[model samples]
Target chain A: MTDAIELPIAANSDVVLVRQRVRTSAQQVGLSLVDQTKVVTAASELARNTLVYAGGGRVRIEVVGNGARGGLRLTFADEGPGIPDLELALTDGWTTGGGLGLGLSGSRRLVDEFDLDSEPGKGTRVTVVKWAR
Target chain B: MERVPILKLGDVLIVSIQIDLQDQGVLALQEDLADAVVESGARGVIIDISAVEIVDSFIGRMLATIASISRVLDAETIVVGMRPAVAITLVELGLSLGGVRTALNLEKGVALLEDRDNARAVAVPR
Candidate 1:
């Protein structure tokens, strides 16, 4: 694991910034154009979720290496009204917030690994990683 | 907030997105395009996204919404120049862009609009 860069997700512009930073880090980890696009797209979804669902949050982006290969990892955490049902939240086309509801489920398909943790009154944290192939 | 420019060409309105758009910019473009379609009385609207690197659900939905809005306004919307990688990502992202029409490039997009116009003219006399 290398040094991580953390950015605040307070508004819509922050989501764009997170995407840009994730794309840069993905490239630095030697991910291909397609992989970079995938991760960056995933970052955009999660970043927006943090801002819109959680009101505000922060993200930590880092480059990771496993043996000989490299990967990019992102952790998005928000302290707002957390999800009560993880399964429902991950369901396709399920949304309480007027969005298309693909933010969580769709992003999960884009990356290599995904983990979501949330409590109704606590917070939500989503961690995703995409390894270079 | 930066706004995407809309150019007029005869009966078509063209918008080429060259910047990494924020969500607000995306919404603004939608409103602007709808207004332009009504005000200019354009028959077709073409969006060029060759310069855009990624298309998340928000942008994907924006395209669909624009198409729906233009259809109601009696204008056709064609999205052109989607990168292959973005295409792959979009499919995996579960956004089929069902109601949106797409072409490989701007020229083909214009040709498609013209073809549709010709077809309509043939189908209806006037």
Candidate 2:
């Protein structure tokens, strides 16, 4: 399973398209419906966050797995104003926009693995993984 | 997406979900909504999602959360208008709504609730 999906997040709609691609790709590689849905959901959330919070962004979902613990790794990057305090933003009930502030933090709950990186004036990138047995 | 609120069939409140259905607001709304629906004295609820283009694990979980609250409040919960594409995406992605009820569309979902209320109304004749 060596497929990488990359897309620019200029509009909110693109998030849906890219997430669909991830779902298809994961299923193509023997990922179960449940596993595929879990990852796609997380990926879609990241994509939307990039579009809304980051102004615009892109994504790359790579398959990284071994045996029973196989999983998908999603890399979401955006060029918008990065989060000044990643720790505070990760806190529940804390949001800049009207949302529940669960885009970054909530998405983390769906997958089995999570990692995020960002810098003010630079950009933000989030990575997530969902396991399949 | 347009929201079409179904009125007066019974104690059931059906709110058409016709937006992005993304992010956290949906999550918090689920909480407030369950309480609101229960507080509104509704016997059941149906959320239309035909216009929704995308769904994630969080949405699935949130839907389940809504169902849980509804059950605790003694109200029925139903999800309507699930697109085939979205369903397939969720299936392949391994995302599931857990225990929430689903319908082909809002009309069917509302019918279920209305049917229940209609039955109850018939049983309690004035």
Candidate 3:
């Protein structure tokens, strides 16, 4: 069975909410403290990206189990201007905003699975997953 | 708006962040801390983040900026009481927080500041 929670990502406060929910879900899946932190931090980065780049969107967090392993999966979907170059965007130190440019690449490094899809003038969707050891 | 309280302890400034910070809130804190450093002539600033569980890139940059501001103002800044989880996340996020000194807790942070002060005093001629 897959259980998911949907959180709105319109405002800055929603970023914090996403992090908290992600942490709770990570803990519930028996993720180690370090693993928990990594997933939550990734969620925070993606949630912020959704708010800033996508002009606000929604995130779906789900808990999944595979045999003896359990994991958490997060999906961030936005309807704002999508990225034109997914390759350059994934490069470190590349940012369209006045940020440290660690939102995309850094978050990708923190999780076990990552996927990105964006179409210019359309929107962007990012999915990441981290499994418990 | 929630504001992080900056307390003056002798020639040091103590800021304890007890709540998760919003974008505006972090900006306000940056302003307030800069003003406090100038107004109080504090020689050191100790920030306690034990109560804060998360520090994204925004908040991470805020800490680095605060440390930079304090350095320019002739004050030392030390971040203390970071949760282990936060530390792990910060490293994975690739924010090394360069130029910022950190301590395990407030007490050690104060001691580190004092050590610096004493070393300076001993090195300088009267």
Candidate 4:
């Protein structure tokens, strides 16, 4: 059975909520402390980006399991002005705002699986997963 | 508006971040710490992050920025009580917390700062 949780990312405080939820869900799946922290931190970065860049959005946290492994997945969706250059946006130290610019690239490094899709005029959806070891 | 309180301990400032900080809270902390350092003549700032369970690139950058600001005001910043998980996550997040000192706990952090102060005093011969 898969369990999922949804959180609205409307403000800075919501970012904190997303982190808490991610941490709890990661812990529920028996992920290691390090793994839990990684997912929580990644959730925070993405949630903040959803608010700061996208103005507001929603995040869905889910637990997935195959026969061999179980993992945590998070999807952040936003209807804001999307990125025009995916490559540049994924580059380290690249920011369109006054931020550290480590949100996208760093989050990708913390998880086992990463996926990002964005359109110039439509919206952006980011999905990340961390498998239990 | 949420604010992180800064407590003055002798010439050191102890900021225990218990609440999950938002962007404004972080910005407020930077401002408050900078002011406290200048107003109280603090020579060391100890930030206790034991209660902060999650730290992303933004919080990591906030720590580095605070350290930089404190240093410019002649104060050394030491981040303490970072959990093992947090340490691993921070490295993976690609934030080295450049130029920021760290300790295992508050006692060690304070001792380290005192050692630095003593060393500075000795080196200055004053």
Best-fitting candidate, scored by DockQ: 1
Which residue pairs clash within candidate 3? none
Residue pairs clashing, model 1: none
Off by over 4 Å in 1: none
Over A38-83, each residue of candidate 2 has an lDDT whose tens digit, in order, gives: 5777777788788878888888877776755556778899878998
What would the TM-score be for candidate 4 when compared with the true structure? Answer: 0.96
Give the candidate order by descending TM-score.
1, 3, 4, 2
Query: Per-residue lDDT of A80-115 in model 1, one digit per residue for the tens?
Result: 999999999999999989999999999999999999
**lDDT by residue for model 3 over A5-122, one digit each (tens)?**
9999999999888988998999999999889988988998999999999899999999998888999999999999999999999988899988999999999999999999999988
Compose the digit string of candidate 3's lDDT tens values, residues B11-120: 99999999878889999999999999999999999999999877878889999999999999999999999999889889878899999999999999999999998999
Instruction: List where candidate 3 sits over 4 angstroms from the true fold.
Output: none
Interface RMSD of each: 0.5, 6.5, 1.2, 1.0
Please tell me which predicted candidate would have the highest lDDT against the true structure: 1
Candidate 4 CAPRI classification by DockQ: high
Candidate 1 DockQ, CA atoms: 0.94
- State each model's CA lDDT, in order: 0.96, 0.73, 0.93, 0.91
**Ten residues in a row with the worst lDDT in model 1 chain A?**
A1-10
- Residues B41-106 of candidate 2: C-alpha lDDT, one tens digit per residue: 777878777776656655766778788888889888899998776686565445566788898987
Q: What is the lDDT of residue A76 in candidate 4?
A: 98
lDDT of 1 at A4: 91
lDDT of candidate 4 vs native? 0.91
- Interface root-mean-square deviation of model 4 in angstroms is 1.0
